[model samples]
Target: MMKKSFATLTSVLLGSVVVLSACGSGDSSTGTPAPGGTPSGGASGEKVTVTLAGWTSSADEKELLQQTLNEFEKKNPNIKVNYEVIADQYMDVMKTRLIGGNGPDVFYLDAFEAPGLIQTGVVEPLDGYVTADFDTADFEQPLLAAFQTGGKTYGFPKDFSTLAMFYNKKDFKEAGITNPPKTWEELQDAAKKLTKSENGKVVRYGFGAAPEIARQMYMMKAFGGQVSDDKGSATFASPEALKGLQLVTDMHNVEKTSGEPKEVGAGWTGEMFGQGKASIVFEGNWAIPFLQTNYKDLEYGTAELPTVNGKKGTMAFPVAYVMNKDSKQKDASWKLLSYLTGKEGMKTWTSKGFALPTRKSVAAELGYDKDPLRAAIVAGASYATPWVDKATLPTIMNNFNNQFIEAYSGKAKLEDAMKKAQDTANKEISAAK
Candidate 1:
């Protein structure tokens, strides 16, 4: 699943977490111990509490994180972790607290929001804190790169997920389809055969589509088009981008073989596929647990998304643990941050598969690549695009999604709608600058 904007944070679907004011004492700049306290950087003596804040999608995820923290505490007996849950408006609250200088020592940062927050200079650069023992190279390059800017590291991604095709086995059998499509052309052929209609009312669609920019960015890339240029200006409206996007629009409008969740009165593609309204959907690992819990009887298989223009592509959403530049307990905060993203902690955090580990070692140790349902997802890490860009992405995303929906609904042409979106977004970015 894509990392959503702070404005759209939901307690039910996105999970819950907490934040806290700074507590305890130490040097804010270097993590050196205060006078009469043990030396800093090493967490051997002089107990210090580092506050960690993040949102968990469920109680299990929260507990899993707590277990990791508990292990860190045992290893570094001098440090105590204060876990806080932010119920809603996570980014809004985080930004407010950051500006006020009372933000948590360590917190969760989505890659999509990392660029914007890092540019503010309040995020501590972890390059210095990273040690040889940390094995920085062990992390998947693309995931780690999301938090890097100008060769400086701001955060370490804790976990990530890539989009994969989820197809209902029963639907495939009923449609006389033997396998999932491996290319866009084959996908169209499959869609035509799988579509079921009752008096032209479309009782079932062959594909479920998401019109949001987050989901369509890879589609844009398939044809050598990009969402934004090096300057962070909108470029998705270009002809190359539209060539790939048109496939989706055509599938829904002209071919009439695909539909979004709203068309079937569902909340998301996962639900649309689970309810048998759509035989196939492109979703992330988040949907796996959802179906297992809510649609237990649904028989589905996962596969790497079909290649577009002969190239495989998918969106990767990664979240990291970052330190506040102003934290008084910088040393203790680093301990917590490093431990959580380290091999031992990451293995535990991702053991249950709520999310995929960001570290290559952890993923191989967990054997997710061999797990029947997770293999395709793990295979995508090699080429997945990190869902991130310049700070103006939120604004660009809002405008694009608004207009893209108009095109998806057949109310406007994709080119016209995208041009309007790009113009409006660039104007907003320019005005903000």
Candidate 2:
């Protein structure tokens, strides 16, 4: 699963040594791996155990990953996988282990954190391990690009999710709306019609707005504005960005059609929509299971987000399995990594639908494109902007979210808030440099 909050990489000096024994695996130095990532003795060599580490979001996710590993082990008896759950502070633990030379052979890496980690030279560049049969071209370009830098591949995205509009069917019917909005203007009109007020007091909001940078970055892209420049410094305060962002603030402050989760006493947009406090919300594939488990009676449907300025856009979150550069079992690890992210392996991993496959062939084989609820999500992947930038993204996101809420809550002008947020983020980036 993708990280809920952006975590910045803390620079750690590489000279310090912290000896920690990797668990669940035998000595890995017993085997001499063959060229092109094949285990020694052509499948039945001196056994090597490769460690794969990641933080699991749910028991189901952990079990599914174990099941996938089991299959891999059955295929390659020589390479046993030691699946390790980092449990908490995954990145911090990973960074420490990597610097101390005790990191797992292969580990999970979110697209957001890939750039920063790769820059430290801890993640193995995966291009040399790739062969023609790996079908690297099958992966979604945008998702793959997140783990790439300077024309070299660092990791392969295992899966991805894109934002989609989740609307309550009952609310739509009651408001006499037949279909989802196709444009920003239509969404505003529909939001006004769907908003409910009783006795001059606002009851249910028409839309649940997530006013954070993660959600608003795509909005900025609707105009010509971008999150950063070529140098990775913040540049989101331009007039073009405010043009799209003002639309959100105006809906909440002026039209009063939309409100954030906090205003409705909810913790998140998903909870706000599930509680019937908001008629619509932008969510991803992860919300489906949450709604199913928490609000089984809620009748909701998903659609691709409304187009902005004649262009369709949304944000994508992807995570990959990256090999540790210092891994002694590089060949064995590549075998496991290739299989897990391969078409067949990916299909088995994504069969339960808890996650969406990043491989185009796997997605098509699963028929998510035809499913009523997932079709919109599948459609968005083509045009979705990845929730990834340079190493400065975490700093940029924190400053932007802190100030953007002021504008969303009508406490500050959109232009002023964005200018402050951008200037503050850039200054921090410069100081860090």
Candidate 3:
């Protein structure tokens, strides 16, 4: 399935208005007008409006969120939410407004771009807002840790995605395989057997090789390699990392069981699997909803990504709700942020199976623990490693992704690809420092 991409925020904020209103007539404990109007007989006479920006393309999701916002407004009569839908190109638009000192009070922050934004001093730390009653412990460890930096919390994780093996059940049955592969070697063997051709024309491929950096990052961890060391330096040239890259390259060039991204013309690994051209593809949990909605005819099931040499690992990517440091309404922003990531909102947002809640309690409330696919995603969170490096990730990703494509196409050796990537990343990191 083709996963929905996040839109850049630049265009969304161009004509948007900043809303402000009085809450009540009487002064609050803070001596400020409540939000929208004055307090009347202990009842909130007005409303407080706050702006939030996010990339949500699904009408169902938007309706669900609007319902939740209505509930929040009913409970806290003083607060109202103005949620803005930024379709695509969210980052480019958001960055422009952020640099101009005028942007949404709260916005979405993906794992891939969080580091760069945090480094720019535009995001506010949330430590002062969080209290013991907030129940931070409800969140899973890896998910919660993604937004922490230098002993301060920069954002609250809302949802997460973890890599898992998506297999075509019909293809597996056709290949006479009754069970999914549990280890790297078994995966390779299964791929080879499932691959079929007729008269030199390939009819079906066993796997799809997505030469993107994120997919390769999971493989790197499976081989027990780290993208960066304690001092935050590039380590993609490590022997273990090279081995992981070689595994995928070998699958395409040596095993002849996998097709490159270009060859499949799907633009993504999950799409290839959903089309039945590939038997197995490693993709994130978000692919589940996409597949169910788009390719309802495909008989598919998901499992934990097969282990590498008996050592299990996968990639975890989380998107958090971050507050703007320069917002005129910081308190209102925090309140909205708190509500969205709070237990109730978490349940509502993740209940549709669009993404997994970062909070363990929220996952339980959403019954994810009982759902096999969601359970696998939650379980993978513990052993999952992040694909991003704290420094020079964009440059490193560009270098690695371009060179790795060559290896995937049999135009370059894995070792040579890694060597060039490592050198380029190291130079970029050094210059960045």
Winner by lDDT: 1
Candidate 3 deviation (Cα RMSD): 4.9
lDDT for each residue of candidate 2 in 1-433, tens digit (9 for 90 to 100): 3222232111111122234466322363544554434233324467778888776667788799889999999998877888877665667788888988788989989877888899899888889889999998889888898899999999999888898999999999999999999899999999999999999977899998988888888898999988998899999999898888988899999999999887879877888899999999998887888899989999989999999988899989888999887777777888899999999789989988888998888899999988888889888887889988998998998999999999999999889999999999998999999
Candidate 3 regions with alpha-carbon error over 4 angstroms: 1-46, 230-232, 431-433
Task: By lDDT, rank the candidates, best first.
Answer: 1, 2, 3
lDDT of 1 by residue, 179-240 (tens): 99999988898999989999869989999988788788888899999989989998989999
RMSD of 2: 4.2
Task: Give a tens-digit lDDT track for model 3, residues 2-61.
Answer: 242221112322223333222111223232322322221223344446668777645676
Ranking by TM-score: 1, 2, 3
TM-score head-to-head 2 vs 3, winner: 2
Candidate 3: TM-score?
0.88
- What lDDT would candidate 3 get against the real structure? 0.73
- Quote the positional error of residue 182 for candidate 2 in Å: 1.0
Q: Candidate 1 — which pairs collide?
A: 17-85, 17-86, 18-84, 18-85, 18-86
Regions of candidate 1 where Cα sits further than 4 Å from its true position: 1-44
TM-score of each: 0.94, 0.93, 0.88
Candidate 2 — which residues are off by over 4 angstroms?
1-44
